[model samples]
Target: GPAATWDAVDAYFGPLVGEDDVLAAATTRARAAGLPEIQVSPAQGRLLQLLALTAGARRVLEVGTLGGYSTIWLARALPSDGALVTCEIDAAHAAVARESLAQAGLAGVVDIVLGPAADTLRRLVDEGVEPFDLVFVDADKPSNPVYLDLAVRLSRPGTLIVVDNTVRGGAVADAASTDPNVLGVREMVDRVVADPRLDATAVQTVGSKGYDGFVLARVR
Candidate 1:
């Protein structure tokens, strides 16, 4: 029943946001290439686009670039002069995403980096890269805390940090859990709680992707 409701909500709003042929083709390509279907749903993608637009984001950092689904959304929200850098560890995924981004006419706008995300973020920090207006972390679930720290390092005051899948079907509430993914999300939450430089909150969500939510933080 819950899933049906989420499906209904997605169906209800799907037409309002419309659809992108490039995005659809990208998903199709990823499926053909055996990439996992773990992308943010259309509604979630549009929400990301809207958030970037609302924030007037000019530069964006994405920790995951799976098929560049979400990357397309964020890139489209930016001005032509804007830039988006995304990281993916899997060479196949990065190649697929590179093609997808290029197909979306975003080849010049998005830089798809191939490597471990933690290392890439650290290098960016070491190079004194310009602060990003928004950072989206959606890669390895177990590295969320590390990614969050890196996001902070690449951000400035008022920067928005969005970490996906923080509420893994409610497993984050299990204080006794040993599952590293859940624990990773928990650790990130704890870090946010203890840190005074961020104002953040979590919103539970249900969609085609099922039950999960993201952590949204504003650097202070």
Candidate 2:
């Protein structure tokens, strides 16, 4: 389970948002094609869309590009001229994601970078790309803190930074959990809480995707 609260949130909102048959069909196809778990649930997808819109995000950075489900959500929220840069380590997955985005008519709005996420992020910084209005971190768990650092560096004041799977099925809340992923999430949370440049909060939720949690921070 990702987060119990996610279940409640989904129950409340799921009925309100009409499902997109195209997106649903895409998800089914991706699963049948043997792609590992990559699609975000409809609830989470909607949340991503809402976040992008709320931030008025013109340029967004996504630390992970799974099957492009979330990319579609984010890209759809952007203005016609807006864009998103998404990083994916697996070339095959990136290719599939590109196809998925193209199917959604959102390929033009996303730039997929295929490589180690750390290297890709560093390259973005080195290239002197403009600061992003929003950043969503959902890559390797052990590398979360490093991702957080880069996200901060690439964000301007008021920029929103959202971290997915922060709670990690409640392992994050159990002190006895020695998992490196749990420890990394704890460290990241502490760092965000103490950082003078950001205001942060964690929200727990549950849905068809199971229990999941996310940490949202606004750069000050």
Candidate 3:
């Protein structure tokens, strides 16, 4: 019931913002290719684009690439020469995202790496790539804490980091919950508050996507 209302609100306000034909096509293609329909909502995607623009980001690191939906949104915020590196563990999902990104004309701007996210992030760190201006972590929930740690390593001072799906429909507040996802998010929250290298906060959100939230942190 509430989700329907949220969807209605999104539909009403979505037109106030611009809609991209390419984005719609990307979703359609992803569905046809049997990809999970778990990408961020349109409003969230716009928020990401705005955050990237606000940060004046030239380099963006994304820990997940699901059909490249969010990847497209983030890449659009970058300058022509800007680059985005996204990690995807599933080869099938990576192929779908690769095709979608190419259709979105962002194939050249975004690199889709197919492998375990943690290993990929570690490799990036070992390669000594330039620090990212903004980092988005949206992969496996059980690895959120690890992802946050790695994301920080890939970031420079003043870098912005966004970790999605932290709320998990409010289950994250259950200290005794046995869900690996919830426990992982709680651990991530604990780490964020304890680490002096980060200044962070979280915001709960309700929309077509439900009652999940995201953590926003800035490197100190």
Could you tell me the lDDT of residue 86 within candidate 3?
A: 98
> In terms of TM-score, how similar is model 1 to the real structure?
0.98
Kindly list the per-residue Cα lDDT of model 3 for residues 54-148, writing each as its tens digit: 99999999998989899999999999989999999999999999998999889999999999999999999999999999999999899999999
Residue-level lDDT tens digits of model 1 in 1-220 = 8999999998899888766788889899999999999999998998899999999999999998999999999999999789999999999999999999889999999999999999999999999999999999999988999999999999999999999998889999999999999999999999999989999999899988999999999999
Once superposed on the true structure, which residue ranges of model 1 sit more than 4 Å away at CA? none
Q: What tens digits encode model 2's per-residue C-alpha lDDT throughout 59-172?
A: 999988877778888888999999999999988778878888888888788999999988988988888899999999988888888899889988899999999888777789
Error of 3 at 212 (Å): 0.8
Candidate 3 Cα misplacement greater than 4 A, ranges: none
How many collisions between residues are there in candidate 2? Answer: 10
Per-model lDDT: 0.94, 0.85, 0.93
Q: TM-score for all predictions?
A: 0.98, 0.92, 0.98
Please give the distance, in angstroms, between residue 209's alpha carbon in candidate 3 and its true position after superposition: 0.5
- Name the lDDT value of residue 205 in candidate 2: 66
